[model samples]
Target: MVVNEEGDILLVKNPNRGWEFPGGYVDKEETLQHAATREVREESGIEIQVTDLVGVEQISSKRLNVFVFKGRPISGELSLSNETWDVGYFTRGESLSKIKLERYKERLLRCMDEQNTPFLLES
Candidate 1:
């Protein structure tokens, strides 16, 4: 999750996933943090400096593993990519309503709360 100085969380609208944090599969020879930074830039046109790993989620059924990180925007303006229909920063409350999926919503909430961060979950 990337948060701006105003405390607005960054989000991207995906065709399949609606509104969610900007992310994608890690490329070969790329670190998880590097992938996160690249994905954010590609999807939202925002360069971010990742601060810490917020959580890790694995879904056995889908053979999917995701590393969620907390970050701050370093530069760039909000722009849309082919992968994302829209991108913008929103308040925490607005972000909750914009992100409809429970799994994604949970991640955002946990990342936003310092006490509940750095979590691990498998499903």
Candidate 2:
């Protein structure tokens, strides 16, 4: 999930779930990075670069592995698809309450931990 320069986190509302980050299962022969970028674009119509693999979530019931990646918006305007009912950026605190599921809210908070981002070295 990507946050803007103002520190607002991006969120997409799924029909089953309330508000969550844009993501889905990685397709066959497709790269994880590509999948992350594509999911965000398809759901929010925003281009983003996958910056880091922040965390991994396992859905025991579905036996699914969700790779949570942090990203930054590269380009494109906000647009919605059938996958998402709404798309927008929200403050860190707002996100805590805006998300319906408790675990989903935890995931958003975890991504906000900036230490996950590796610092680039400079000579």
Candidate 3:
């Protein structure tokens, strides 16, 4: 997830899944860092410097490899895209309540850790 200097969490209003951090599957021949930067730009129309690979969520039933990256916004204004309806920043406590899905909330919490230990969350 990308955060700004004010300690607000960035959220994208996904048309299908409600609110979530900007992320998607890595494209062919793309590095994880590149994928993250690309996803953020595509969903939120912002540039970010991906700081670290903070965690991974391994969902068995869905067979999804979700990589959680910590990032800071470097450029661009808050704009909407085809996949996301709204882009906004909120506080940690605010986001905790606003995010609709439990699993997505969990992912955001994991990535927000100050200690930055990589996690393997399975479900």
Candidate 4:
């Protein structure tokens, strides 16, 4: 997931309930890093530079690759695409309730808890 200089985490409000990180399934030819960057731009109008791999989670049937990125809002105003209804930033506490996926909240908390160090996972 990507966070901008304002200390707000980027979130896409899914139809389900809460908001979500702007990312989707990886394309066949694209690398994971590129996929993350593309998905962020497509979902939210902001351009980002991915910096690090944060953590990974294996859900019931899906393998999720989560990356922690320190990015700047280089260009584009916020626009809601087909994948999202609202696109905005939220503080860590605000994100817990704002994020639609429980797993996402958990991951964010994990990242926050490990702020001083870096986290990496395989598989």
Candidate 5:
């Protein structure tokens, strides 16, 4: 998940564990982009526009659907929902240390380093 000039990647602090991108399982028929956007909004209360396909990754027991996009903050103030504890942006280094999901941290760094290229998935 990506956001504006602040370089703040939208993140949700999961109640069950640590921080993660605001994304969930894709519905049977929903496109990955749709899922990414919906998940971000649902979890972070921040509506974002998904611009490009970032990448995908599979870890341990789950298949992660990662989509890196340019998001413009549409509306809604950040709030902690049932699934998330906090929602905000942090610097790349900060996110690396603060993000709870190890895979997400890896992907975030990859996305940043490869921002000029198309999405590429890593297992």
Candidate 6:
């Protein structure tokens, strides 16, 4: 997730997932951090400097593992890509209300607190 100076969280409205942080699968040629930065830029037109690893999520149903990161925007403006229907920054309360999926909400809540050690969630 990318947060601004005002502590607003950046979110993208995925057609399938509703509202969630900008992210996708890591490329085989890219590192985890590089993929995170690239996905944010591709999905939201925002260049970000990833600061920390928030957690890892294991989706048993899909046999996939998602690496979540916390970051701040280094530059670029918010714009939508084919992967995103909407892109914007929202306050903590607004973000929580905007995201409908429980797993997505959990990721956001976990990322908002930087003090927490990296976590692993399985579902």
What are the Cα lDDT values of the candidates?
Answer: 0.93, 0.83, 0.88, 0.73, 0.72, 0.91
- TM-score per model over all chains: 0.96, 0.87, 0.93, 0.81, 0.80, 0.93
Q: What lDDT does model 5 reach? A: 0.72
Which clashing pairs does model 2 show?
Answer: none
Candidate number with greatest lDDT = 1
Which runs of model 6 end up more than 4 angstroms from their true locations? none
Residue 118 in model 3: lDDT: 87
* Lowest summed lDDT window (length 10), candidate 2: 114-123
Give lDDT tens digits, candidate 2, residues 34-60: 989999999999999887788776667
lDDT of 6: 0.91
Estimate, for each residue in 1-123, the C-alpha lDDT of model 3 and write its tens digit: 898999898899998889889988898899999999999999998999988778888888988888888899999988899999898999999898889999889788777775756888888
Give, for candidate 5, the lowest lDDT window spanning 10 residues. 58-67
Best by TM-score: 1
lDDT of 5 by residue, 15-104 (tens): 776876777778899987788778888888887777766555545355554556655677777877778988888777777888766766
lDDT per residue, candidate 1, 8-120, as tens digits?
Answer: 99999999999999999988999999999999999999999999899999999999998899899999999999999999999999999999999888888778778877888
What's model 2's TM-score? 0.87
lDDT of 4 by residue, 1-123 (tens): 677787778888877655877877788998887888888889898888877666655443445555554455667778888888898988887888776577677667766665743565444
TM-score of 6: 0.93
Error at 30, model 2, angstroms: 0.3
Global CA lDDT computed for model 4: 0.73
Query: Looking at candidate 5, what is the lDDT of residue 36?
Result: 76
